[model samples]
Target: MKDAAKASGSKEQTADTTGDEGEAPAAKPKKRKDNKGKDAPHYSVKEPAGYYPILPVQVVPAAERPRVFAYASSTRRDFEVFNRYDLSQDLDFLILEIRQGSHSPFLLVLMYNQDAPDDTQQRGRSFERFKALALPDMPIVIAMDANEHHPLWEREKL
Candidate 1:
């Protein structure tokens, strides 16, 4: 697992968030500015203490494999993991919420769908459950890898 960690660019270091005694006022989330073609700093993660390893992640299909795992960063003490939704084992999808600052919390859904005809029913049921779980008038972001070839998306070929 350690070897896999290194191979996958997982670090064993902790983030630095030390400061003075009194807590400073929390800054508003800033929109990232254009770098004018320059490379931006890569987002990195540090495995916190007592990190657990889950094997057989590759056992699932590549498109429907588990991707998102919520972890805490010592620096971002304002962020909180609220809820987790497990829809199905066959369909690889995860739904969770993370709240930051005084703003309304939003749902983050990580999904991957296979564009096969046989998977249509399972996908339909999963989406139905997803809709049922969502709260009205709340923000939701679905980050997905879909293998759909459609003219609407300008994908004329599969």
Candidate 2:
């Protein structure tokens, strides 16, 4: 995916930060409290220079040719154009590498998981795989469509 998106020939990327959602509101620049005086760039949903924003992918046109990777629960005839890696052929996960002009390359991982609590083990294993592939310095973004109820991303109201 990195080679394809970085190829000089492709001009524009159809997929933008916006995926299914249309234009809704102006995106705010996400800040990290830990990044005090650090050189790490705070990636913007509009034009991410150094990092890849995982969630809230909007469908607007990309500023440039964007690297795209997707994993589907079922094989589809649509995405055959892109190279597919079968490392975990049984798992519904895919990864893409994107590099901006002169910026360090980052990874984007998209995954799907079952909603049942019993499926957490599989999710954990998938995360472990992702961590293994990630570089220490490279930024990573994981986009997941997990319907499970969990406190990690959600908290019950007091």
Candidate 3:
């Protein structure tokens, strides 16, 4: 049985090498045509003034793929740490709240961190310990610093 396994392994290796040798070179993907000139067909699309429509985003359902509700404290220390460690992986949405007004909820985005490295391999690890804790899929709101940094205005010589 051991001899047969070794023979099969050798045959598989030889077959893989032969397959590689017989395979054609990969072709480059086709690029889309630039529609910058007047010859390009223009669809009749009108934009409403003062009221912009929210664009639809591709998001996997929570049932199929677990969704994360990530938010930083008012100091944004956690966010900075997460960003530095490149830990925002497998997160369907990244909700960033600009302000915590008297009656304002949070703004969200159904996207992953574009800047993180090895994100594919580190899938769903972004949730970390939070994964164990059960949470609802409701809107997560995080109040942020309205003006964290401001230039001090002092009377000085120009």
Candidate 4:
């Protein structure tokens, strides 16, 4: 969403709360502006530490297979691993075939990419690598950031 917003040069949306709740219940939410007077995207400080929140991440997809990370906060186990993939082993995606004995199974994917939408050559990557994972049986969801220039962005400075 941020990428799309930036591409069109519009105000960014965020999930942040300003802690000023005295407004009327039906009032529009406030917008935070950057120093340039343009609305800024919501900032986040959570990553790997649950003390606040999980951050936008830099995935270190395992160099070798059979590596899985999961969180189970409840007694019922609903997510089961089907497979994990890294395009050229580059953190492409993860597939979960969620099968709980009494219910019909479904596929779930948790994915994020820091790649620019068009910087295929930057990481020695291309759409051809992504095609290998396009299962004729399952839908794919992808969201990537494309920053031409931004200080907070983590896309390699090359």
lDDT of 1 at 137: 61
Clashing pairs in 3: none
Model 1 over residues 56-141: C-alpha lDDT tens digits? Answer: 12223322323334443445466665334232223345555668899998866666544324744543533454555535466889
lDDT of each: 0.42, 0.39, 0.28, 0.34
lDDT of 4 by residue, 1-158 (tens): 11222344433222232222242211124655655785433342322432222112222211211122233223335533332222122333334445566766554544433442363443423233444554535444443332245666656754
Q: Model 4 segments beyond 4 Å from truth?
A: 1-70, 84-89, 116-131, 134-158
Please list all clashing residue pairs in model 4, or write none if there are none: 46-55
Listed per candidate, the RMSD to the true structure in angstroms reads: 16.0, 15.4, 22.0, 18.0
Candidate 2 positional error at 130, Å = 3.5
> Which pairs of residues collide in model 2?
17-57, 17-58, 18-57, 18-58, 18-59, 19-57, 19-58, 19-59
Weakest 10 consecutive residues of candidate 1 by summed lDDT? 12-21
Q: Write the per-residue lDDT of candidate 2 for residues 65-144, one digit (tens) a residue.
A: 22233432223332322222322222345555555556666656676644213533444544555555534466767787
Clashes of 3: 0
What does candidate 3's lDDT look like per residue over 1-158, in tens digits? 01122333432111011123243322224322324522211111223443221211112211122233333333332222112111122433433333343444433333432222352444333333224334335455433222223356434522
Comparing 2 and 3 on lDDT, the stronger one: 2
Name the candidate that leads on TM-score: 1
- Give stretches of model 2 more than 4 Å off: 1-90, 115-125, 128-136, 150-158
For candidate 2, report its TM-score.
Answer: 0.32
How close is every model to the real structure, measured as TM-score? Answer: 0.41, 0.32, 0.23, 0.30
Our tally of clashes for model 1 stands at: 0
